[model samples]
Each structure stands twice: as structure tokens, then as C-alpha cells.
Target: MLQIDLWKRVLIWALVVAGLVLASPNLFYSRVEQHNDAVKAIEASGATPEREAQAAAWPSWMPSNLVNLGLDLRGGAHLLAEVKVADVYKARMDALWPDLRDVLRPERETVGTVRLQPSQPGELRVRISNPEGMTRALELVRGLAQPVVSLTGAGTSDIEVAGQGSDIVVTLSEAEQRATDERTMQQSLEIIRRRIDEVGTREPTIQRQGTDRILIQVPGVGSAAELKDIIGTTAQLTFQPVVSRTSDAETSAGVGNEVLPSLDEQGTYYVLETAPVVTGEELVDAQPSFDQNGRPAVSFRFNPSGARKFGDYTAANIGNPFAIVLDEEVISAPVIQSHIAGGSGIITGNFTVEEATNLAVLLRAGALPAGMDFLEERTIGPELGQDSIEAGKLATGVAFALVLAFMFFTYGLFGVFANVALILNIGLMFGMLSLIGATLTLPGIAGIVLTVGMAVDANVLIFERIREELKTARGPARAIELGYEKALSAIVDANLTTIITAVILYVMGSGPVRGFAITLGLGIVTSVFTAIWVTRLMIVIWFERRRPRTIEV
Candidate 1:
């Protein structure tokens, strides 16, 4: 009999209604977006009257989830940046120098006086006064080497040590270099993501391109330069012992020391030890606040490890000046008044309120492991995005109208049923996208238009089968039942193949390609549900109410 179970019928209608309700907010996209933003702001900070009104623009009980727009649709900043992975090598070698000096100090009778010598980048050279103790120096430095912490680098040490005349040269091994490059790239991606998320942008794409390059696409940013400014700041904060303050920029910083100009004082340079007491990586929290003199400053709190190091350094070096360095420039050189405990400190500089807040944001987000050189940069204007949206709307409307007209005229009453189901299917597809928070691009719109055409295939097959069934002298009810049963295999087979293809595309592709795959995959699921179940239920209801003796297909 051409009848659906009562529970099944009710479930079908419930799903249809739910999908349409979930998709209804997209009809007033801008208003719902503003309401969603207002709600988020109210949660983050207390709501004002204007924000309250915006939040009230939409009903509270309704679903507020929206399909996020992609970079193409929303307009954004695009950048291809090459990371300077070699920069980390220099820092690694500099940090190794202090450890090497400490280890060789015990052997001063044999190794004589161990002194840091100027060397090329990525190499640490230590010169000993006595050449006869070269074997002892090499043995001690090589003893400090540890096995690389990687599967491919198993059995290889992190550093390679060799004797060159009276100097011992230490450099990172090849396996360790590869590991460091991978770590540097991963850290850069994370820091860039955090920095962009701090600004509250939607669905920004931050991904690694090659071995040492990153691709960043941020939607709703004003320009590429603005996006760069937000993420490009290295914000590498370190506290080091200040050797001396000098006005001569060309003055030699001496071995194991570097010269950095002061941020607040022009023409003032400070020579500081290359090794830091504590780095920004140890910081747990940073916030903008006022100092004792009521000036804008950034207050920072460190983790336990950082706190211990900072406290020990300050306690042992009372009255000695320590340089606070940011991105290789000395921000402040302040004398330690006493043992500053608890690992909390303030960085006071010549900064406006906005600068202090931005600095705090960068500090909280953490520093990039390596510097980035912008290889390609582009800014897409919102006006262009609006034009693209309008074009997509026109194409979708035309395709929908054409499909609806063709379906209605070709199969008469059955075609009208298919048309109604098609509408519901479109709504269901959007509902799924919103629920999943999928990003919609221009290619995604094309997938929707394509779906409108493919959605009526099942109904057409069923209608043709019924036409043949009616010729074989079957009763109207039996013909309709057999028609649906026969068409079910074909519909499932066709949609199943398409869904598999969509899955493959999604897995192998990226960015806009994945957007298209998402829409296509979701469309097939909704189309199959509407074609096989919703249309059948509607036809069953009509036949029951009419009690027609015969039906024309």
C-alpha cells in the first residue's frame, strides 16, 4: 500500500520544518550577523544599550549559527611569507656558548682561559689560551651533545663539535637542523594563528606552503599591510644583563655581547649579553596597565620556571642594570633595586595606550620562532566581494527558476511534488552548512546551482516507472508502490557515487576547492532525503485524501 508509518511521516515533517527554521536567519544575513556579533561582544564584555538593541534584533530561541563566508566572498588580506629558519640557528648557538663556558670553567688548569671568539653565523667558536688542552676541550663539548628527539634523527646528536687550531667550533648537526626547521615552521603557524585570532577575524586561513613558507588569508581585514602589522611583529622579549651603556653605535660589544639601541632614548645604545635570563616563551600572561608613575605600561607574569630564573638573576645582581630587549632592540635598561620575587614585572616605555595594548596582545600570543619576509601580498576590497555575491545570487536565482519550471511542466502533478521537495532540500543543505559552520565561497555557490538541476532526477525516474506500471494494468496504489521501489536502487546508486567523489575532493583539495566539495557533498545528502522520502510521503498523503481510482503520470 502507498502509506508511510505515522511515526516516519511525523519525523519527516519535523526534519523539514527544523531545516527551514534553521536556514531562515540567512534570509536576513546582515541583521543576523550583527546580532551574533553583539551577542559575542556581550559575552566578552558587558553590553551597552546599543549592543542590547542589536542583540534583540533576533529572537533568542532561534538558532544563531551562520555559514561563514570565505575569503573570496568576504574580501580579505592575502600574504605569502618566507620564514627565515636560519635565524634560529644563530640564537641556538649563542645560547650554547654560556653552557659551554660553564662546563669548561672547571678544567681551567688544563684548558687555560676559555674565551668566546667571534665566528660566522650558526657557528660557536671558543678559543682557549693553551693549545695543548685541545683534546680535553673537544671531549668536554662533545659530552654535552644529546641525541636528536626525532624518529628519522635517531642516533644522531644535536650538535657536532670539532677542533680548529686553538678554537673549538660547535654547530648544529644536519638532523637537528631539519628538526629545528620543522619546529620553527609549526611554531610560526601557531603564533600567526593566535595573533590573527586575537583580532577576532572569521575563518582566516593560516597554512604552511613549502618547507619554509606560510600562506595567510584573513577575511575582513582592511588591507594586507594591516594584516602584516598584526602578525609580523616578532615580539621576541628577553631580559639580559646589560654590560654597559654607550652613545657610540659603532663601539665593539666585545665577545659574547651585542649592541642594541634604546627604544625610548635616541642615540643611546646598550651592550648586553647575548644569552637571556628569561625569554617571552616563559611568559604566561601579559596585560596593559599603569605603572607607579601613572604611565602606560605592559605588566607580565611568568611561569614557574621563568619566575625562578628571573628571581635568581635579579637577586644575585642587585644594583646591576638589566636590558629588556624586544625584537633585538633594547626597550629598557633598568637597575635591579632589590630581589624582585613572584616572577611579575612591568615594562615601562615611551608608549601610548594603544601601543601598550597591542604589545600586551603580542606578548600574550607569544613570539614567532623566526622572522618572516613577505614574498607576496594582496588586498581584496569588499566592493569586489559584494559584486561577486550579487553575481552568484543572480546565477542561483536563474538556475532555481529554470529547474522549478522544468520540473513542474515535465511530470505534471508529480513534478510539482518534486519542486516542493527541491525547495526543502536547498533549505536543508544550508541548515547543515550552518550547523557545521562551513565557509561558503564562490565555488560553493556553483555547487548549489548544480544541485538544483540534479535534485529532480529521482522523481523523473519514478514518474517514468509509474507510467510504465500503469500500462501493465496494475491498480493505482500498486503501481505507485512498485514505481518507488524500483526507482530506489537507481537513486541511491547515483547519489552514492557522487558523494564518494565529493569526499575524495574534500580530502585531497584545500581552500576554495574544499568549500565546493562541502557544498556538493551536503547537497547530495539533502537531495536524496527529499527525493526518496519527502516526495513519497507527500504523494502518499495526496493519494489517500483523494482516493482516486486511477492516476495519470
Candidate 2:
């Protein structure tokens, strides 16, 4: 035995073995993660044909692969949903004008046929529709306290109400218009958030940018095609005028009311009421279930006010077929079905569980404003990801093999000792990534490859120092002792700079950059122990077991 400290060797081995123990959980957890599914299963419908039809429908609930796969490797969809701020602003302008007109209608008319219309700078144009009445109303309105400032237009002497000058404007100023746009973006994001939550996918990110766009990322979501369909749909519910059977036969197929309850007259569908009775905002909850006859149906409950409104409408309509149109397509139109006084009702149709589920999802998600057209869509497939993993492993193995060969040939026995430490360090990195749930991406693999070469540098420093120490004619014990002590300062100084760079990268990076940073950071710490400490301890054990007369580099 080369009379070296056994305690130091034992401590070094303890760190390595403890790392293995700590990392073991990641291996076991990864197995479970691999087997997890991403799709949800719907309960079977009793209709054999319907159930058979649904047999091909994959479950929406995915139970595994929580970490996001990169776009190149995984085939998934990507979409950029533009909020259409200008369109929203226009709609808001149209909707708010009526309310303002009504609020000031009495005064404007009281002043004898005054006209009120939208103008610049919260401006409104008010002229005498009835000159005699307008004169009386204006005197009262001018005296009444309000935030409005009145002006006369250039071409005509019409009174202009504006925050700025004589422009006919509504209550909404430039700031308010911007605020409305901002609110639309926020509300749209909320709606998107709710929809994604219902999807039950893992690691999905939905972020808002500026005043008009939303970015969504779903890690393991396979059906990005369907995801865009779900997100792009505004889901707006309207109370439109409906034409009955026999009235518009040419416009629609007057099928069995069972097949098409919402057809117009003459076996055609009715023109839906252009003015909505109530929006979809009142819907509280929805679920897919079987009716008493075991047929697929969507059961929905409304808010108290919606329930009362629905009841009133049904009670008045009697046997009229009322339509439930979502995004302009009639989903269901049951004949006033015996007065749904409870504010809850069922939509019965020839629907499968999957069909009913999608409806439930849309209803639960509420509707979007206007017609939200899709701007962009991208779908990713998982086959590519698996192939990338294989390729990454190949490249990593090649680099590691090269490192192993170089180390074994370069320093001879001491190099062999460092190579073993390098292998353990890689294992330790893997185990920790698994344990901590760090996703391994292509860039992360690159970091691992780079670390393999880096780990060798520490060994080289120690081995070269040991060779220089031998010139002093010291014993093997003293030579190794001086070598570790001398290499410590340089090793720490070099790796500290790396760790600092890694910290900066992590702070400034996003997604894959962060993944690379994490791998690099973990590598640096493990390399310090394995390269500096592990090698020294292993060499000591070698000396103790077979104490050689002269240590060869």
C-alpha cells in the first residue's frame, strides 16, 4: 500500500455513490414518464355505431411527456393568434355610440331634433333634428354639469362634443380606445387560458404580446391542428332571427326535426335573429352525458339571470323552435321543450361522445368576439422527436467515446482513472436531470458533449502537476499531495468563469438556451468533484493496493 490517506478516498467514493443514489429516482421516474399518455378517454356511448365511430377518436388527455419537446423533434402545431385590435376597436366604437346616444337622446331631442354621431376626441355631433326642440334641450344640457366640451364644426354650426375641440366624439377618448384594446387583449388571454386548462395538457405556455397577439406552446400536445381550431374559434353566441319551416325551404333542408331541428320553413332553415337575445357569457357549466334513452347529449346550466331570461323566452315562444347557434352554425334548436324554467337544458342530437365533448368544451370556453380568422398554424409530429433523440444519442456517444479514448491513451493509468470519473460524472448529470425534471433537448445534449472535453481538462491539470512534482524527488504520497494542492487554485479559477457565464446565459436566455445553461451548470459542479477529487482518491487507492517504486505518468 502506498501509505496514503484512506479517509480521503472513502469520502471521494461516498460523494460519487451518493450522487448515484440521488440520481436513481430520475431513472425510475423517467420510466413512468415514458408510459404516461396525453389523451383523455370519453365514456362509451350505448349506440354501437356511435361508439364504433368514436373508436378511432384518440383520447384528448395525455398522461405522459410533461416536458415540452422541441419543434424539430416533435411534430406539433404552432399558432399566432392576432387579437385584431382594430376590428375590436371598431366594434366597441359601434356598440358604445348607441349607449351614449341613448344617454344624451332626451336632451338632444328635447332641444328640438338634435343629431348625435361619433366624432374625434370623445366628440359627438349634435344638431337640431327639430330646431325648435333642440334650442330648448341645448340650453338645459349646456347648463347641466358634464365632462363634455362643445364646439361648432368648420362647414356647419353643429355643436361638437370633444375632450379636445369641435370634433363629434363619444365618451371614449384616445386613451379609452387604447384601454379598450388593452382590455380586449387581456380578456382574450383569459379565455385562452380557460380553454387550455380544460384541455388538461402538460407544460403549455400561453403568453400575450403587445396589444394584439397571443403565443401558445403545448409541450406534449399532439393535435396542434385541433388546438388551433379550438383557439381560433371565437365561440360567440348570438340571438339571431330564425326563419321557420316552409318559409325558407330553398335555404335549408327541411329534414326530420330529429336530424335538423333548426331548419328554415319549407324544409329550409329560418334566418337567425340578427340581434342576439343574450351572449354566451351567461353559461356557467356544461358536460356530455347520456339521456334517459342512452343517447349522447350535452347538458348545460346557465347563470340565474340567464335561466330566468331563457325561461321567459321559452314561456313566450311556446312551441317555436329556438336555435342555439355557436359561431353562426346552429348546434341545436329544440322546440321550446316544455318551458325550461330551471335555466338548465339538454341539447339532444345524433352526437357521439367525442362530438358532444367538443361541444361541451366550446360552450365551457365561451365564444369569441366577431369572426376570429386564423392567421398562422404549425403542427409538430412526435416521430421527428424520437429520431432526434436517437441522433443526439449517436452524436453524444461519439464525442464521449473520443474523450474516453483520448484520456486512456494520453496519461496512461492516471488518464484511465480520470475517464472512469468522467463516466460517473455523466451518470450523475443524467440522474439529477431526471430527478429534477429537467427536459433534455438537443442543445442540452451538446452541453453534455462539451462538458466531456471540459472534464478532461481538470484531469490533465492534475496529472501534469503530478509529473512536475516528481522532479523534486518526492515520494508518491508527497507528489500526489502537492499535485492536488497546486491544481486546486487553477481548476477553481477556470471553472468559476464558466459557472459565471452559465449564470449569465440562464438569466438572459429562453427555452432551449436555458436548457443548455442548466446542463452546463450541472456539469461544472460534477466535473469539479469527479476530475479533481475522484482522480486523486482513485490514484491513492491504486498506490495503497500495489505500491510501485516510481509513479509513471
Candidate 3:
């Protein structure tokens, strides 16, 4: 009556062994982490002698996954950045000019000459020589409006067109602005994540905070400034037709052109077309390499659409200067000698090898849609992290020892069974965390310590029930059977409620709070399993072998 099936016993033991094996990697966290990093490097680039040696530091067959340490535990850079979302509004308006010009130019006979009139940052104002044709001009410009591709913006156009005297004013609709903001935030998060990931940092948290702000936490980075340099560079590479090269910064760029200072030569500027032939967004790959003269450079390849555009621009503009612009600065302006059919090209600048590599990384990660103003930045040192880790270890060890002592002193042999299960429960929780690549923070450690005390609750319930049954003169076997049976519902009900609470916390929380919730939730599940199954099995095996007529719980 108090027996488990053969298969069930085997399955339970197998799971326990497997969990302990998975968690064993954490015991040698530093060595395993080094091995993992070396393995990743060897996979990314061919294995070198140093990397190979590091990779062999840990056994190949052993589990290598470790619980990722959070920013607070590992210590690194934290930044709160407010994105300049209004920057995209100006860019949008500037881009609309070309489309508006192309559309209105076809109807020149009716609308007369069109001129761009600069207004506010977000508005594009176009003036026609013939004011009477304003209706036709507005209609033609409004034709360029597309339906906003968002659920909340259904049936609404992206641009709102209005007439103001002889000018046709165009601005983004409210729906489109909301959609753009969402897209900008998402893209910023992704690009920042990619940039940090490229640097091989562990578990960097890049997430949107509010409407136009981002919170970036990178672990293992040198400093806040270093982290900023990695993700904050706009890296907005563009190839534009050069209107003229000038030494004076005050040179007028005229309509549809922009003047940018040169990066390599001070006091030199290039007036370039407002619209680029190809942007960094179109780049499929970028790598650090050398130019013809063996100087540090970035070699880049374009996607198919970009390749076609670049090839067409090069063929049509042979002998004309093409400006390579990066973040409103001209990196180079070279005269095109012949048609460049392929989409591959080299970007040579006054760059060191490090600069070239950084540029390549940035280009591969893609440009930020808007600039960020860092509102808060802090650099946490490894010494602080080590202190936190030591404190956590002390707290956890104290909690574990106290729990083990209380259970052993009160419940005797049965308490020893609960203590073993409790230890295994911790191992199982860590195994789950390592398997899922969960990040453990200071709060998560607190959660695990809390779990240590809670893990013995089911055992106490069963032991108390057995004490009650023994007083009723039931045999040891029947008393044990009734004890487990009576405690089952209570154990499930209590742990289930706690698990639900953890789930809610995880859903509502962010960062460290989520880390806490993860550990709490997982600990509850593992605790329930060990309490209901592992401790019971141990007691059953002991009772079967000894055949005790009367047992002390």
C-alpha cells in the first residue's frame, strides 16, 4: 500500500541524478564559464592554441551551462537613455521632400515650379508658383500617404496633408507618430542588444523603460563610457553624391543638399545630396579589413536591393565624387573612376585598427533610429560584485544550516530524510536555472534562501500526521501510508498558491524582480517534488528493510 511502482522509482531517481549533474557545473562556475567562452570563441573564429587550452579546462562530456549572474551580482555598466524621438520626425520630413518633388514635378504644367520652404522640425512645407493649383498639389502629395501598418492605427494614413495659403504642408499623423515611436524603441533595444552581444558580454539587459527611454545594463563591461561607446554610436553610414567640396564650413548646401565636416581632414567639408544612394541599413555584412594601401578600413557588402541601387548609382555617376557619410560627418569623398557592378566596397578613413573593428561592429549592429541622451550612467566595479556575492553566500549558507539543524533536531530520522530532499531540491532548482539560462541576482538568492525553510513544510505535515496516526494505534506501515495520504492535498494546495504568486510577480516585474520570481517559482516546484516523492521514497525504503513494528517519526 505504501509502495511506488518500479518504473516510477527509476524515473524519480533518474531525474534527481540528472538535475544534480546539471547543477554540478555551478560548483566550478569560473572554470566552466571560461570553457564556455573559449568554446564560443572557437566556434566563431577558428580555434587557437590559447582558446583550445581554455576549452579543455572543463570536460567535454560534462554539463557546461551555469546560472547567469545578473548585473548587480556581476557588476558592470548601467545607463538610462532618453531617445530623441523628435529627430526621426525631422528626418521623415526631410525624406518626404524628395518624394513630394518627384510627384509634383510630373504635373509641373499644372502646378508650376515647386520650391521647398523650411518650416518647423516635423513639418514639410512646399510652395508652388501657381497658388490656384494648391488643391491639385495637395492631392498629388497626399497620394504618397500609405496606410499605417499597426493594429491601433487601422485605416489611418501615415501623413496628414493640409493647405496653408500657397503652401502644401505635410506632417505625420498622430497614429503614425505612435507607431514610429514604438518601432524606434523596439529597434533601439534590438540594436543595443546586438552591439553588446557582439562584444561577448554575458546577459546584458537592454530594454525600453518609458515612452522614449531605454535602460541598458551590461555585465563585465569595463565602464559606463565603454558600454556607451559600444551601443551609443549612431553609425549611420550613407553614400551620397557630392555636390561640392569646400574648406569653409559656412558654405550653403542649397535645397536637397547637406554640408558635413570631414572626419579625416579638419576644416574641410563636403556638400552632399540629402538622400543617400545606400544606407547602413542596407548593408548585409561589414568586417574590419585593410584598404589597397594596407591601412585599417571596413569592408562592407550590401543586400540585393542595396546592391542594385549602389550599382546603378555608381554606373550613372562615374567620374563624380561620392561622399561616404557617417553620423553627419564625411569619412571620405572619392571620385568614381569606373562602374562598380558589385555591391562590395571598402571604407578607408583615418582609423586605427581598433576604430576599424569598432566601426565594423557598429555597422553590423545597424544604426540607432535616433540619438540618445544619457540621463543616468553608473559603473559598478567587480569588487562591489564580489562583496555582494560573498554576502549572498553567507546568507544562503546560514539559512541552509539553520533549516537543516531544525529539521534534524525536531523530526529525528524522518527529519534527516527531509534534509536530504531539501539539499536535492536546491540542486534541482539550480539545474533548472542553468538549463534555461536564467540570470541570478541578489534578490534571487534571497528567494532561494526563503525556499530552504519552505521545503520541509510538506515533510512536517506528513510527520505530524504520522504522530497523530501512531497515537490511534495504527501499525507503522499503515501510519506512514495514512500520513502521506492526508498530507498530499495540503502540500499541493500550499505550494500551488505560492507558485501562482511567483508567476504573477514574474509577469508584473522587470530585471531583478523577475530574477527573484524565477528562482522562487522554480524552488517551489522542486521543493514540492522532493517533499512528496524523494523523502517519502527514502522513508519507505528504510521501513521496508528494517521492518520496524513501531517507528519514531
**TM-scores, all models, native as reference:** 0.97, 0.68, 0.96
Q: lDDT score of model 2?
A: 0.66
Ranking by TM-score: 1, 3, 2
For model 2, how does the per-residue alpha-carbon lDDT over 15-86 read when each residue is reduced to its tens digit?
A: 777667656544444443333321132332244554444433332242222333455555556777777666
Misplaced by over 4 Å in model 1 are none
Q: Per-residue CA lDDT of candidate 3, range 239-315, in tens?
A: 98899889999998887788899998999999888878888999999999999899999999999999999999899
Clash pairs for candidate 3: none
Q: Could you tell which candidate, 2 or 3, scores higher by lDDT? A: 3
Candidate 3: worst-modelled 10 consecutive residues by lDDT: 117-126
Better by lDDT, candidate 3 or 1: 1
Task: Report every candidate's CA lDDT.
Answer: 0.92, 0.66, 0.92
lDDT of 1 at 41: 80
Top candidate (TM-score): 1
Q: lDDT tens string, model 1, 1-553?
A: 8889999999999999999888888888989999988988898557999999999999999998888888888999999999999999999999898899999999999999999998899999999999999999999999999999888899999999999999999999999999999999999999999999887888899889989999999988999999999988989999999999999999999988889999889999999998998999999999999999999999999999999999999999999999999998899898999999999999999889989988999999999988889999999999888888999999989999988899888888988999999999999999999888899999999998888888888888889998889999889999999999998899899999999999999999998889999999999999999998999999999999999998877
Best-matching candidate per lDDT = 1
